[model samples]
Target: MTVDLVVRGARVLTSQFMVEGAGVAVQDGKIVALAKDPHLPEASQVVDADGKILMPGAIDAHAHIYDPDYTHREDWRSGSEAAAAGGVTLLIDMPLVLTVMPELARQKIEVGERESLVDFSLHAGMMTSEEHLRRMPELAEMGILSFKAFTTKPFLASYDYIEELLIRASELGGRIVVHSEDDQVIERGVHRVRDVEGRKDPLAHHDSRPPEAEVVAVARIIESVARVGGYYHVAHLNTARGAELVAHAKARGLRVTSETCVHYLVFTKDDVKRWGPYLKMTPPLRTKEDVRGLWEALLTGGVDMIATDHAPGTREEKEIGWDNIWEAWGGIPGVETLLPVSMSEGLRRWGIPPTVLCAALCANPAKAFGMYPRKGELAPGSDADLVVYDQNLEVEIKADRLHYKVGWTPYEGIVVRGWPVLVTVRGEVVAQDGEPVGRPGHGEFVRMGRWR
Candidate 1:
């Protein structure tokens, strides 16, 4: 049968392996066939990949974009543009910056339908209070597949609250994702350095959020999950010890998974000293040894996936921490560079196989977030969202060339060898040559199913 489009002459990544000399046929916004035999079906359109790699579009499961309160930093339109430019076809947004109540989640979904250029979903934020916890099942019934919680101040949930949320989530068949950090440990660290003159140093930010804080919180959350029996995911995990705790938890068969961002695997505390607020993120960058351990974990299955944790803030907002480490915004603009940076460092420098990278950036995230087969696979019946990557395209990253409203990137000047030249979301080319060609409001709010 004739198809809508065919992408030929590329190595196509499937769930099991990469198929060389393969072509993908698309129809009605879904994959119809992965052609390997000489004879091919007639199609209305054909894209010659020219030996580039054709894989399912990357799904960033962690990102903050277009909080109604922080539109100056990033909005849904701009954030989706950046995601398209980075070859991300879908991004699941974190709710910390946005309203996470059920009504707000519905409102954001409406906004995304009118503003985003890529498919998206939102996680409901679990608050520390009982009123919010009472709304958990309502949020789940509204199609939010997961809830997000914090264990540190400004967003911290009490241990009892966390336990209640976990139990409720288990009952609702919903998952919980957490920004795990021990509030008390961090408080002590802050108090220990509160009067010290050295507290002004950017490294002091790292000091305030020690690795032990994450390790302690991760262990606590795992135990809570084990006791309550629900699917749990840790967001933007930063330390090796934290990874170890997740690994051990998984060994016991607790429905737990964790992910680390590109920065944590690429940068260390040394970068915080060099780039200051620009490099600062919650949980902070760790030691070089931790970086090594994270990479090892990625390769060894200790980590489930890699995400951008793409939170962007204006230069002025970041500069607030220049005189005092505690005052700066704690995020980096990364959705536009996540794939390129990881491809360069993970594949070109570290010799990581492309299949492994695909699993981390595409497959694993889809599976974890209940968007698999539809968003992360190229097999027949899956949505035809794909990225055409040229592994030899060498380029230096610069904020001026990026699409973030924040106007800067922590990865500026870093050279990356591989880059996405063309990106398609559901059989339509949304971006090419690092620029988004799709219009605002073209994207739809994706409703995720329950995770098994």
Candidate 2:
């Protein structure tokens, strides 16, 4: 049968291994075949990827696009444009700037369907109220994949509230993703450090949210989930102790999983000192030893996925913490650098396997959130979302060249070895040469099926 597009002569990464001299054929926006046979079906467009790497487009499971509100920092259009430029075909948006109740989730879905340049999904946010908990099943029926909860300030849920939420979600066959940081620990730590002589320094931010806060909260969540019996995911896990807790929970078959962002895997507290508030993030960067332990976790399957946690804020918003560490926004723009940085550091620098990269950035996330086979596989019948990466291509990252509305990157001036030269979402080329060619409103909202 004739096909619409053909990608040939590349090191194609499948769920199992990378196959050389292989070809992937697409027809009607779905992958039809992957083979090395010379008698492959004819196609209208053939891409020669002789010296490149072909894999399923990355799926960023955690990002904040802040649509409908907080557009000054980022909108769905700009966020998806940055995702396309970074080789991310799909991103699961967190609900922070926009309310993620049933009505608001529908509104954000409408915005994404009308303005995003790449595929997207929304997570329902959980608040510490009986009214909010009562709406969990309704929101789940409305097609949200998981509920997001926070254990720290401004959004903290009490232990009893979290336990009830987990039980409710378990009853409805839904999953919960948690921002794991103990509010009590952080509050006490902040009080202890707030009057210190160096409290205004960036390092003080790290001290205020110590690694113990993460470990304590993660352990608490694991205990709650074990008793409640539901699928649980720890979002943006930063500390090695936290990773160890997740691994221990998994060993007991608690249906738990965790993710670590690119920044935590690549940067340390030293970067926070050098870049100041620009590098500041919640559950702040940890020590080099912590970084090493996280890398080891990724290699040994202790980490389930690698996401961007792509939250962006204007320079002015970040500068608020210059005089006092507690006043700055706590996120970094990363939707546009996830794949490049991961490849350079995870593969070239640390010797992580290519298959492992595919699993962490693509397959595992899809399976965790019930979007697998359709989004994470390169086999026949999967959606034809793919990325062509040129490993030898080195480019220095700069904010001016990025697509974030915030218009800056924490990774500026750092040269990364591999880069995504072309990205396609469902058989259509959405980005090329670090610029988005896809149109706004071309993106569609994705719904998740029941996941175990």
**Segments of candidate 1 deviating more than 4 angstroms:** 37-39, 196-198
Consecutive 10-residue window with the lowest summed lDDT within model 1: 192-201
Q: Residue 443 CA error for candidate 1 (Å)?
A: 1.0
Please provide, for model 2 over 139-253, each residue's C-alpha lDDT reduced to its tens digit, 9 standing for 90 to 100.
Answer: 8787785888899877878878888878887777778899999998998888888865447787788878889988998898889887878888999998888888888898898
Measured by TM-score, how close is model 1 to the native structure?
Answer: 0.97
| TM-score to native of every candidate shown | 0.97, 0.97
lDDT of each: 0.85, 0.86
User: What would the TM-score be for candidate 2 when compared with the true structure?
Assistant: 0.97
The deviation in Å at residue 5 for candidate 1 is 0.9
Model 1 residue pairs with clashes: none
